[model samples]
Target chain A: MELVVVSVLGADRVGIVAGIASVLARHNANIVDISQTVVRDIFSMIMVVDISKADVDISQLRRELEEEGKRLGVMVGVFHIDVFKYMQRI
Target chain B: MRFDPREIGEVLEMLVFRELDIRAVTLSVNTLPAIRPNLKDALDALSHLLEPYARRLRPAAEKVASKLGVRIVTVRLAVSPTSIMLEPLGDAKAAVEIAAFLDELAGRHGVDMVGGFSAFVHGGVSRGAAALIEGLAEALNSTERVAGFLNAASTMTGINLEAVRRAARIVLSLKPHAAARFAVTANLPEDVPFMPGAYHGLGQPDAVVNIAVSGPGVIEAVVRSLPDADVRTLHDAIKRAAFKITRLGELVGREVAKELGVAFGAVDLSVAPSPKVGDSVAAVLEAMGLPRVGAPGSVFALALFTDAVKKGGAMAASTIGGLSGAFIPVSEDAVMSQAAAEGAITLDGLKAMAAVCNTGLDMVGIPADVGPDVVAAIIADVMALAVHLDKPLGVRLIPVPGARPGDIYDLGGLYGRVAVVDASRYSKIPLVARPGTAPPGVERLKKG
Candidate 1:
């Protein structure tokens, strides 16, 4: 199983989590952890998900997520769990 | 279970509309003219000098605004005293020409306000400084973004009756549209990073950054949440909140200075407020048990609030300075403005309040016909208080054109709006004319 972290940031609006979650669920990704905070007009969220489905490619999932993010007026970036953990340690 | 749409709408509104976090970006630019032989050449130099800075200023400001997710209300510039450049302009025509040049430059550059069309004749008035004062009304009236100031006295240099007298006349004659942009001061500090008072001094770096952190809402929210808190408890809570706010301000100011590669000037922890509901300096005073800001106990309340804020801010940052007190700007503060409009506060009430707070007679709109000597007298009273207390204080009263007592002038924007405050009909009391004499100092009390 491959673990990944997805970070999203943008103006606080409707359907941000549901859209991202729907895309992840379609790829058979299991959400493990989620944290979110709203400060002023901006919304920020971090999600950790497990993606072990052999049929879905990580690169293809990233493209789909990017499209979803653009449609939702949010910025989304995906990173390997190991890389995210390393950056956090620093 | 069913959810109410009204409740959801209310929550969304609270999230999006209720939360306001905007920072005022004041760009300090020196307007001391580059060496030039003719007026045309001088204007050209002015535009040329500003062009480079202007090109990068708006974009950088917009980027910061976007990143912070807060609106940048103004992209303003503060120039060195125009009096320095007006030395060669011997007559009113020549002075007006300089004003025109400045106005044109400001318009072309898309700057909202340009300060430093001023003179600092604390002890005595020079020829050029006097000329700037004489032409001030015309210059201010003719220009859109130009602001003016006059430093009438200082501790080092005694009060200049000449400058004070002239400033009074200039302010009285100033147009209503331009009145908000003009300020008069005694002992105006050299390193002020705000305007219509910022002027790059020789002691400052070629470029320096200053921040004015304003969150009256935060303070008010803290106070309101503890409705049953005692005065001491309330003061303690305010201090803690102020410490956090000032620390955040210091961090942002330091980062911005690092990015600009200039010295980080002080973080002015002035609780500057807007006309928006629930953000007010007077509300803080009201929370302290005063029915209104001008009540009998108001001055003492202000003293406590001001002292506590300074104590907390000083502890928060090493470089805490500027007017680091609660701003009592009448028009800018919704409650104070309302009080003035309802006749709950008067000009004398404001003067009494200034004894404690650093700002005296700030943004208080008055009549145009008010004599300069009377204005000088009012300034003298406030200056004497500052000297007596040995604390920083300033007076920025606006004598709105064609306005009188009971008239309201709407300045709009961050300046907010104000109803005209009635001027004191009484005259001055005779006092000694000594300058630089230290007042009786208060002994510091040791806390257990």
Candidate 2:
């Protein structure tokens, strides 16, 4: 309930950020932190969202983000924070 | 704790895109109190007693997995073995009733399986044990969720030829649909999560939770990235990947256990494979540079992978029970099935690899014409390997009636598909291998 990890990756294109943000906002998952960059025309972004007050379940948010990602020709992934802490720590 | 985006992104990739999952979370419950005679008076009391213990099982598991974005393949239960509970009744009819009762509980809770409709007869068999074994096919055939196993051999006990033969005949008699629900195991641990072999051993706590973690796709990705690395680096990479995968299981398992107020038993670090392309253990082996799973250099490939998995997983979890190694179940794995389909991996080769890996001749499909004696022989050979090597092993062979070797035997879904595998030419063997009169080290080993 504290925060969820959301990552997006694909070719740099128009409205990728707005598209992702609008969907997240609509679900009431407030973005606590955001980082985005375009390297060699392939765009990558990571957002830390606080979903303690989100309007939808994590699975529903994931489904919507995936659909928007498809429309934007990108791949979106939403995962629990434990995945990050366990795999990256040791 | 906040995590760096790049580090977290990599983990998200593994979870979201790589098919990582907590394969199963099994709740081992105590059903001893419900063991009563099959009378009108007892059936009503038994259901009332079992209802409260399992009432929240499925919901608790689902809530926890959903909150964490973890995909839990199944929620199952392992009760006290049925043979002991029905021993006093000495009625096969009562045993069948118990099996149906358990399965009904599972259906109501939407649980995937309920194991421990089983008997351990390596030491000796009794009248009730015989009744359960003879009634096994009927019990399993009648229930969708019931699972049964016959542990006929153990490392310390040598082998029980009689039990092995009886188990083989029972397997042949099972309704084709019941094949997936029954297993013949050797040297199984107390807290394994795989079915249809999982049962709560006498030593286990009354209400413990065991987690079976599977991530073949994640492991294959690691091996694929280090294509040219030497043996040392490859081993290290595998260890690192296994550590991460098993840690996920421990974390999720502990949380689920805590939420359910049950004792956390162990993290079973078995790398489960399915028919899916990337999820096969054989695919992970192929990623390690073998052309295919059964080609030259395949056995050593499995040896390396299995050892590294155990080494790495042990570092992550405090208690690792179950079959904690890479499983090579044919029909359940695409590469293994393909290897059998092409005749690249023979049944003998499977036995040889079984010595080095976790299980023996697992999920193997043989010719429909093969007799019960031959099937019993194969199982006995596997039993011997487990006792000699001091490892836990199981046999889940499928005798696909009307299907010849190399033909596709499709059981469908998670039971998967297997190409019928050719066995060594059968030779006549005694119905029960004559027991040795007085083996030298047997008593001392049993005592120790």
How many residue pairs clash in each candidate at the backbone level? 1, 0
Which tens-of-lDDT digit does each residue in B1-448 have in candidate 2?
A: 7677677766776776677888889988776666666544445766776676578778888877866778888888898888887777887888888888888888988888999999988767877787798779899888898998998888776678788888888877775558778888878888988888788788977788999988889889999899899999999988888898899888888888988898999999978888877888999889998877788888899999998899989988879998898888888888889889999888888888988988788778876577777888888888888877778788887778888888987888777886888754764567445553112225337557
Those runs of model 2 whose alpha carbons end farther than 4 Å from true positions after fitting are A9-13, A23-30, A37-43, A52-75, B39-42, B431-447
Spell out the clash pairs found in candidate 1: B153-B187
Candidate 1, superposed: residue stretches over 4 Å from native: A1-16, A20-33, A36-90, B1-22, B30-38, B258-262, B400-404, B427-448
Candidate 1 CAPRI-style tier: incorrect
Cα displacement (angstroms), candidate 1, residue B246, comes to: 2.7
Alpha carbon RMSD to native, model 1: 8.2
Where is model 2 chain A poorest over a 10-residue stretch in terms of lDDT?
Answer: A81-90
Residue-level lDDT of model 1, residues B43-109, one tens digit each, is 6787777676655555655555433323445655656677777676545665677777767766776
TM-score of each model's B chain? 0.86, 0.95
What would the per-residue lDDT of candidate 2 be over residues A1-90, giving only the tens digit for each residue? Answer: 668778899999999999999998897899998888899999999998888898888878888999999999999877777666766776
